[model samples]
Target: MRVLMVGWEFPPYVSGGLGTHTYELTRKMPHDVNITFFMPDRGEVSVPWMDIKRIKTSIGFGPYMTFGGSVLKESIIKSVEDYAKEVGKTAKQTDFDIVHCHDWLTVMGGICAKRENGKPLVFTVHSTEYDRSIGNPCPWVMDIERYGINEADGIIAVSKRIKEQIIEKYGADPGKIRVVYNAIDSSSFDCGLKFKPTEDLILSLGRLTLHKGIDHLLRAAKIVIEHHPSAKFVIAGKGDKFKDLVEMSIDLGIEKNVFFLGYVPQEDITKLYARADVFLMPSVFEPFGITALEAMAAGTPTIISKTSGVCEVTNNVFKIDFWDTEKMASRILEILNYKELFEEMSNNCRSEAKRITWDDIAMQTKDFYESVLR
Candidate 1:
């Protein structure tokens, strides 16, 4: 089967989980199926059986007479029309069997491609803007999300939480949505010999955003410090909330205990996870917390918000409400102070991580595609 995937960001240009998902999905898909990845940015990466096509989104005159080139800056109507034309051209040239789009950024391109090719369109909802913004609704985003969900022949939600959000917020048919949990590349995060004595490291990985509830984690850190003053809190990743979170740590008088390690590479992240005794994600709202899986894979006990989707998969980790700082801190201290409990949860976490892999995810996604085509 030939599939044309429309996505906004591909690795190196990635800003969030969506880019990682697209890159890994295309890379690991079976060689029998031909996949073409279309993105806005040009990058130098290639995959077997997958063609990475960078759609030029620039507009200018001659080489020297250029003013400004913005293919995506066109009016929504013109952008949609242009996308429709391009899709018709590509479909005539390639004769693909399916048009798959990831998220709302590529919805216009996907809709056009689906209409032009007369093939089944599959839309993957990594997240909804409504979920990201909590209750604050943006009509434009909601409209686009609804259009993509309504147009697709099939829709993929990363978690049941997100699936319900789609149905509730956009009034999508629940039956049409498939819940495919986000997977991890375990090979990239090798679980070597377990460390006998890990440092007092508590790690949190992801964008430093308001919804991530980093403030909540900092508050919990303050409580945890009273028990284990040597404990250190490390937050990895960069976002608009970095400075705000740093300030919050200072305001809480835990600035000395908290460390903001911004945008560590994947290789370095594994090392950080190996050195950590526990991983905490106290997100106000998380659809599926992939970092918890990574930490678990590294043989570390994880503490997640009860509201997160990862909580649905494993019984090994500690879970608490995002608002319950006292309970969260108590759980962290329990993991730190009690070696027997920590060892048990760590063992369980390792076992749980083995059950999830990108290969299995690829096969499941392939099956979904085949079912949609049929």
Candidate 2:
């Protein structure tokens, strides 16, 4: 099958997890399927089966203003319309069998291409605006998301939680939505048994945002520090909330124990994961926790919140509620203090990581695409 995939970002130009998902999924998909990945920009790396197409849409002042406030408005609508026209032209030229849109960014393009080409449209919802914003909802963002969910022939949700959110919140048809968990490339993380750092390091990697619940991790860090004074927490990633999180860390009196290693590159992250004793993800509204899976692949025992989608996939690691910093810290201490439990969870994490290979993810995705086409 020939597929034209539309997404907002790719690696090196990534703003979120969607880019990583697109990159890995296309790389592992069967060579039999011709996949053209259309994004705003291309990355430095190359994929053999994946054809990269760049589409430029100029966002005017109004769109920029709305984007600044995290609101999608008239400018966003105009930009999407322009993006759709460009994608429609590309679809006519390439003759792809199916059009797959990654998120709301590509919704307009997907709808235009599907209509113009008379091909099936497949949409993947990484997360909804309501989920991300919680109560302070932006009407325009929600409207765009709803339009995409309603227009697509088939939809893919990263987790059961997200699927349920779509059904309950957006009123999407349950029959059309498929739950496909995100995956990691284990081979890249196979740097075996690097020496553990002399200083005890607890690692957290993700965008520095309110939804990520880094403050919750900081609270947990304070609790862990009481047990293991040597414990140092390293947060890697940059976001709008970086300064706020830094201030929160100071106010909690765990500033000395925490280091903000902003935006570690992909290569360095793997090495950091190797040296760490535990990976902490305390996201309040994580649709799917890819970093936790990556940590598991690197043989690091992971502690994730029950709210995350990764909790739905694996049973080997520790799970705690996002608000329960005490329990989170206790779990971290348990993994750290007890060698037997640590080794057991570590071994199980490594074993479980193998099951979530990109190949398996690709096959399942292929099934979904074919089902939609039929």
Candidate 3:
């Protein structure tokens, strides 16, 4: 199968999980299936089996943006227009069996590719606009997502919750939407990690956004430190809520206990994940928790929100509500203080990660593509 893959961002330029999913999934794809990935701009790296097509654009699409910014909206439209025109030209020249798009950022071009080539269009919804904006999303972004949901021949939802949202909100046909869970490549962590009782390190890695429930993590940090003063909490990654989260940490008087390492490089995140005693992701409305999986892959005991899609796939890790900071703190202490329990949880979660491979995700995605094609 030959696929014309449309994506908003690729490796080294990705801001969220969508780009990581696209890169990792395509990286593990079989050699039999040819993939021509169309990215908005050129960035570092290249890989086998897939040809990266960087469309010339007149406008820049920033990796990060606020939906309320008019200039950002205008630039995105101009970028889309340029990308769609390139997709039209590329479609005329290449023979692809299907057009697969990731998120609303590239759906416009995916729709254009489908129109130009008349091939089956597959829309992969990593997260809806509602999920991103915390219930109040940009209307135009919602419209783009709606069009992709309504027009595409098939839809791939990263989680069952997201799949249900599409059916209920967009009134999409249920049969067309398939719930394919996100995966991680555990082999990337080359150094073997064992349970070494050292500094009680609590790590939270993700975008510091309102929906991520990072503030809740900060609130929990205070309680954890009050109980266990020797503990240290590290919150990594950057987002719109960075200033707000920093302010909250100070207001709560836990700034000393919590360290905010703004925008840790991907290369360094693996070391942080491996070294941490416990990894916590307290997302109020997370689509899926990939970082938590990465932590587990590195032998770190993880605690995730029950609302996360990652919870649906595994029972090994501790699951709790994002709002319950006290319970989250208690779990952190439970893992940190108990060596045997920590080792068991870490080992089990690693085994679960081993079961979830990019190869399996690609095979399942390949089957979904073939089903739609048939």
Candidate 4:
């Protein structure tokens, strides 16, 4: 089986979970399955397992872009279109048994490829516009998503929550959608580097956005700090909400307790996960929270929103409503104050995360591809 994968980010060029997903999934594919991966030409990525084809576009936009200006917004919109057009042209010449794409960004290319080759088109919905925009989804993006949902031969949703969203939002056929929970490679968290903190560190790492529920986490931090005064809250990753979240911490009087580390490098990620006393993922509409898994795999006790797709798979992490700051703070304090509970959770999560591996994910994906082809 040959797959032509249309995606945005992969491995070293990643801005978020989508890149990690692509890299892990592709590398673990069955030996019989040939994958020719197509992505925007950021640089060259060579691997013995698969053939990578870089598609060049003049657009300079990236994933999870912050909307600071109309010019930037317009540029990003044009970039996606331009990328799709370029990908379509490339796909027409490439030979593959199936067309697979991630998110709306690559749907057009997938559609074009399917049209040209009459092959099975599989669209994977990592997230929707509603998740990104915090309920107010962009019509343009939504339109594209709807079209992809309707056109695809099969759909893969990262979580049951995402599958439900597709059905409810776009009236997609439930039969065509399969719920495939994302997996983590436990070995990836081992870099031999450690970040020893002077104080108890509470970490929240992701793109700073409205849907991330960072503001709610900040509100919870104020309460947590009142109890654990020396505890430090770290918000890592860059987004449009960076300045807003900083102001929020100040307004809540927890400025002294919080540290905003913008755009953490890939190498330091494992260290941050290893050293953090507890990892917080307070997303308002998280389709699937991969960071929560990464933290849990590192044996860091994780506190996640109930709405997260990851919550559906794991019982090792603490679950709470995104708006419940009081409960969020209480959970943070529970892990901080209690040694036995923390150790038990830490030990159990490490074991639990290892059970779900990318090899298993690749096999399931291969099965899905065969099912779609049938």
Poorest 10 consecutive residues of model 3 by lDDT? Answer: 59-68
Would you estimate the TM-scores of all the predictions?
A: 0.90, 0.93, 0.96, 0.96
* lDDT tens digits by residue: candidate 4, 1-374: 99999988887787888999999999898999999999989987877888888988865666665454577768777888888888888888888999999998889888988988889999999999867887777777889899999999999999998999999999999999998889999888733323333458999998888899999999999999999998899989888888999998889888999999998997787888988889999999888988898888888889999999999999898999999999999999988888777888888887788887899989999999999999
Over 260-303, each residue of candidate 3 has an lDDT whose tens digit, in order, gives 99989898999898889998999988887889889888888889
Off by over 4 Å in 2: 42-46, 59-78, 193-198
Model 2 quality (TM-score): 0.93
Pick out the ten consecutive residues of candidate 4 with the lowest summed lDDT. Answer: 190-199
Q: After superposing candidate 3, which stretches have Cα over 4 Å from the reference?
A: 62-64
Which of candidates 1 and 2 reaches a greater lDDT?
A: 2
Using TM-score as the measure, the top candidate is 3
C-alpha RMSD by candidate, in order: 5.1, 2.7, 1.5, 2.0
Candidate 3 whole-model C-alpha lDDT, 0 to 1: 0.85
Write candidate 2's Cα lDDT for 1-374 as tens digits: 99999877777666568878898898888878889888653335456667788877764321111134434456667777788788888777777899999777688889988988999999999888877775455777788889999999999999999999999999999999999999888767755543334567889998776788998898889899988998989999987789999998898888899999997888899988888988899999899989999898888889999999989998998889999999999988887787777678777787788788889889999999999998
Q: Which whole-number lDDT from 0 to 100 does residue 34 have in model 3?
A: 91
Off by over 4 Å in 1: 58-92
Model 1, position 112: C-alpha lDDT score: 79
lDDT of each residue in 173-277, candidate 1, tens digit only: 887899888888765665664653557889999888778899899999999998899999999988778999999898999999999999898779899888888
